[model samples]
Target: MNLKFIEKILIVMFLLTFGIIWYDFYTFSQPQLNMNPDLSYSRLLEYIKMGWVKQVDLYRNNRLAIIEASSPDLGDRSQLFRVNIPIAASQLIQKLKEYDINFDAHPIPQKNIFIKIAYNLLIPFIFITSLIYFFQSSNNIPGFPNLPGGPGAFFMNLGKSPAKLTESTDDTSFDDVKGIEEVKEEVEEIVSFLVDQDKYTLVGATIPKGVLLVGPPGTGKTLLAKAIANEAKVPFYNAAGGEFIELFVGIGASRMRDLFVQANKNSPCIVFIDEIDAIARKRGGGYGSTNDEREQTLNQLLSELDGFKENSGVILVGATNRVDILDSALLRPGRFDRIIDVPLPTRLGRSEILKLYAKKLSLDETVSLLDIADKTAGFSGAELANLLNESAILSARYKSEKITKKEINEAFERVIGGIAGLAMESGKIKTLIAYHEIGHALIGSILKNHDNVEKITLIPRGEAKGLTWFKSRGDARLFTRAQLTSRIITLYGGRAAETIIFGKPEVTTGASNDIERVTEIAYKMVTVYGMSSLGPRAFIKLNKTRQFPYPPKPMMSVKTRIKVSREVHRLLKGYEKIANRIIFENRIIIDLLVEKLLEIETLESSDFYNLLNQYIILPSK
Candidate 1:
């Protein structure tokens, strides 16, 4: 029986026993009386003295008397009267004898020994039973295996692994996974090994025990694991790294052990732990230093990985975006033999992903997936899926039959910037927003190393009053100093335009985000990229485990820190001056662009560049 069910039964039985005992005691103490008028002791004495009493029956050891008497009120008929007799009723008995009244004294009935014992012991028995239940609930008592606090408590299952076992099926195969051709190729060998272990073992080559999938969030790390399991055609136990952690001591380790035990029992299976960094973080002082439970769980996981035999047939696949913070023991050769990086999709990859998702949507003939892919350079596979989903939503919202290029473009803007908000009315704020965005487009277009302007609009989107997008020039891996400096100057353009048009005192906080980006770029150039006059040296050591909003303190001396700050400031000032000079020189074109932008509320790259071409020559790379 379930322990909780048994506990309920005991409670009901105790209540029933107590009720029965109390009912018996109440009946024994007060027997049912006859239907007679109650008389006072004085009235009874008067009746006896007047010779009106006929007979009497005493009960409860002379404490109650039933008297049969005749009086004028009774019309000479004998009537029974009940009276509560006093302790000293000898005189009443003598009077009854003198009156020749027939009296009989009934003895008190004896109670059952068991009922007496039960009535007296009910409270103590309840107290003792409660103590037993309390001790058993905490699992402190022996010989009570089926009680709470014992081994049978409901919470005892907390130590069990919460991994969901997925039977091998062709529901999700590699064909469904798009935009990661290289990553698919990397794991194809593991699938082959799981299919026919003898193929590799015949040549005396051992299979890798584990594979680590590292990538940014939403880059299809978990999807890749599913694909591998489906291709292998084996039982897949999927669990999150956080599932093994518990508030109770040793529970995390127990869960970790249970997970692997089940994996080993079902040999030739795959165990995929997503977000492994949650438990496999680097040991010792840092973020998880105070969490001994997580440390012990990680230790247990390492032991299980090490215990795997060359032919155990249990392949472990772990995924995390923070591989840098994982313990060295967990990532060692035998533990996580192969480390696969699933990076953001490239241009061609994005196009493939878009096409795969576009198959489900009712797209217009002019809707081009390639064009949308080109605009989304750094989008991951999941993000690409969302873009099409958003486009379809917009199509439905507008009651359109099919998704057109216009819907896709709007969805792209929505995804990149945020949801479009109400457009600002024409006034000082609108003019200032128009000038700010135009300044960014103007500076970006004139820069020799910066990306080309894609679009500029005064329509508010997300938190900004206006927006300007720059077209990415493919997936450029390395950036030059000229390119970095161009980006910084472009970021400064908004603030410079605000200062020039409205004066420094009237400049709005619209450029706050721009100022932050400018500072980050300038600081990176001086402290990280070694592109400043302070010599080619990195002053700030990168701490992968360091969380944001609380970065690790700089290790440099006061003089070095002062120099780094001055260099960053100098970089920002120089870029600001350059942005001001360019904007001031092209004030005529700026004014023209702002007027056209306010009227149409939007300007494409071609239209923007065409207007600029009539004034100044566009810069060459």
Candidate 2:
């Protein structure tokens, strides 16, 4: 039933309950006074004899009487009183006749048949129906699977696996994916295994039971799993790790077993678990630290992978951003033998991804996918897709016939900087921001290792009052010490410029983010990259509390810590000096760029390059 109808039923039931209570209170509200046997019999006689008794209701098998009387002391006022009759008063009917008092007798009341039926049956039925409807219409209870239908269906599905099984006939396949060539190659073997399992068995080569797809989020791990299933033309079962767990402890284990059984029935099938870290977290966490349900579920999953007859034609594929936290037992050779790392796409890969998304859009021929790829160096496949989607939104908003290159770039800006037209500040703040951004752009233009400054804007975006974006020439896999140092110098350029223009004390907190990035890079160089005098060892300790990959903290003595701190300081100070020198030498150019920035609010790479060409010779690395 619809919620509105159920609600009306509930309201009617509530009103009925209230009306019954009120009617019951009003009907059974008669007042009575009690008197002992001797006194009651004497008063009864006196009232009847004096003709003051109007009527008497004999109850309790004639042993009790409710007398409606008018006594001398009561002065014609009718009073309702109860009196207990002695068994010796056998002539009570005769006494009533002699005293001329009207009398009646009644047995205890039996409830009305309709009220009895309503109380014993109808109310409970309504209550149960309403409860079932409530559970059905409301959102899923925490830790419960979102089972469709009513309460019966919910309870019926409670024990069943939450994994969603799909046939390979569905549309997603290798063609739907792009940018991850190596990942596709890694999983292609699984498809071959599923397509012809007997061929592998005849050659005495066993198929890998599990393929662990590890990467940062939005790198297409789940999509790759689906594509593998589609290519293999096998039944595919997809489930998140969290869905296996519930408020009940053993339910997760039960679910894992059920999922395996189903996959086994549909042999040559693929089972994909997204975010496996939810259940596959390392076992033996400290006392009271590990979740029993999750641990049990993980144990069951391990069993299903390599416990018995090797699961025959079942291929298990798991994906997680944090592979570090997974149980080592699950990662061992037999379980997840092939560990496929899906890193962020390279420049060419990003270009491919853009092309894939662009095919659906009415993109202009003038719009260069290669250019957009260069601008989005660190973007993942999913991010690129979202960028295209946002661009389409912008196109629709402007009522444009085709998605222009300008819309694509604006979409990029919106994704990185929240909303457009948000940066509307003016005057001194604007001038300071202009100088800061121009300083970075000028230094980047002068440096050979640094990427070309793509665009500089004095208008605020995100948390900054200005921004200087550098478009990558290509995806550089390795960074030299000179390149890292150049990056540090570029970071300091903004603060250095502010210090030169407004003096040391007047530098704004806008450079705090820059300082943070610089500190991280410096720390990584010394401890992780081992570029410092400290040694070619990673002395930093990884965080044990979390599974998300983060830079390790240094595990060192106080004296060594002080030494590392000194080195990092020296690096930052030296870079700052380089930045200051650059700013000091290009003071006039900085003023001109700031003026141009203030007037236009934004400058493209060509604008900055033209001005740089007029004043300075480009340096060689």
Candidate 3:
């Protein structure tokens, strides 16, 4: 039976037991009265002497009598009256015979003694016994602690550690991890130290007490920790940062202490805490300050890391995406001695990830992992795995034994854009959308710094009525001013095309997202990148707040702010003019492309470029 079902049954049994006890007491104490008043024995006798008594009934061992009589006081109507008889039963019988009244004697009904005992004693005893048994059974359930008195006693287990302990296993190791070769090298050293501690200790070297893994989400931080535990062949204690915190005061601190106690007992173990920033956020009082429980938990954690007692042989590994919000004490030299960064995969790294995931799937002969990797420039390890899984699902849906390139292509498009919507009917709206998308592709082909156009489609996907894809190299870590300017012009191409093809007033709101991106790039150029006439100084200061030890504010004169605004406007206008000129020069090709796009509704990069080359010379990169 489910535990919840057992709990409900026990509660219902308890309520039913109490209900029976109450019902018995009420039925015995309150006798039934049929809307009649009590009469004295003398009054009853007078009624009988006056010949007003009609009938009588004896009840409760003949100690009570119900009489039906007519009297002037009762409005000359037959009425029933209850009266206590002090005389003996034989005497009452004699009196009733003398008056010649019709009478019937009723014997008191006896109840089952077993039922009485069950309602009064057995039921209550069973309820109490079941309650105790339920509490005892709860002790065996995970997460509930066994108290000294009983399982259902006070919440003494609130302080108990909820961390899960896993014995050493060879299921996962560094060999199973891919796409992070540099991070793996750093972590392998730690595993080597754990496997042979004397090698480091003899040379007067101490293993880091804690290793903090900082990176964006889905970048293989947690996977690295698992590999460490498996490679080192030591006990692993896993817990989330949230498990140490609770709403009750002192519970968080108590759990923190208990966690360290267990870690101490299992020395030479790896304690991995995921999302450590939850409990170790910077401590301060402000509008969004954490509660006292969380702060207390953090303090206890600090004490355990580098307190009077030496925490040797216990290596702590923590992973977090938000390292900026962690407390300084938690990140200091003695606590977190090593901080490793796990970044997104590069082009070569992505290829390795794709190959690793592809081993599990059956692909067609023509399908290539390298081509897929090139298309997925910014995808993480988890996303790459998901893309292949989606392709496999599509193959199954189509009743194919092996995944084909067509399925992979469709899955890739679905993952990047949303699911494809219905095909649009050919009309003025479709023509306008075609022109808008063509505008973007034309500008991208003409720009020297922009990436090459990959695909263009008139089929609606997600919130976009039309879409254009760019094939990025994904290896560039830095961009020059010219590259940034070229991106802005490419973004403005759609609006520029719409304004020239249809009148300015006929342009639609399809470019809202594009305009937002253009504005962000232009503002960042002036404020953050210092790429405009505003000079080579960042005008924005980050991490400013009213919390303790606040950062210094950025000082800028009102006139300088105005100049910054003007510079951003100048950058936008200059790029927009360039985009318009390019679109105007390619008007004939644009019309021909629009007609072809309306007929087919889709075009690949090779086909698009083949047609464009027939009309004009393409720009050389």
lDDT of each: 0.85, 0.83, 0.83
The true-versus-predicted C-alpha distance at residue 502 of model 3, in Å, is 1.7
Least lDDT summed over 10 consecutive residues: which range in candidate 3? 543-552
| Model 2 misplaced stretches (Cα beyond 4 Å) | 1-108, 112-149, 286-290, 422-425, 541-553
- How would you encode candidate 2's per-residue C-alpha lDDT over 1-621 as one tens digit per residue? 577788788888888877876765555443244532233678778778788889888876788788887767877888777788889889999988877778898775555776677788778978896776756675454444434644445665666678788888878888877888888888888888989888888988988889999998999999999999999999889899989877787888899998888888888888999999999998877344238888888999988886636538888899998877788999999999899999999988999998888888999889999989888888989999999999999999999999998899999998887665566567787788888898888888888988888889866666766788888777887898888988989999999999999999889998999999899889888877888777787757544322213554457888988988998898788889999999999999889888888888889989987887788898753
Ranking by lDDT: 1, 3, 2
Steric clash pairs (candidate 3): none
Clashes of each: 6, 0, 0
Write down the TM-score of every candidate. 0.78, 0.82, 0.82
Model 3: lDDT of residue 582: 91
Against the hidden true structure, what lDDT does model 3 obtain?
A: 0.83
Relative to the unseen true structure, what is the C-alpha lDDT of residue 57 in candidate 3, on a scale of 0 to 100?
Answer: 89
For lDDT, candidate 1 versus 2, the one ahead is 1
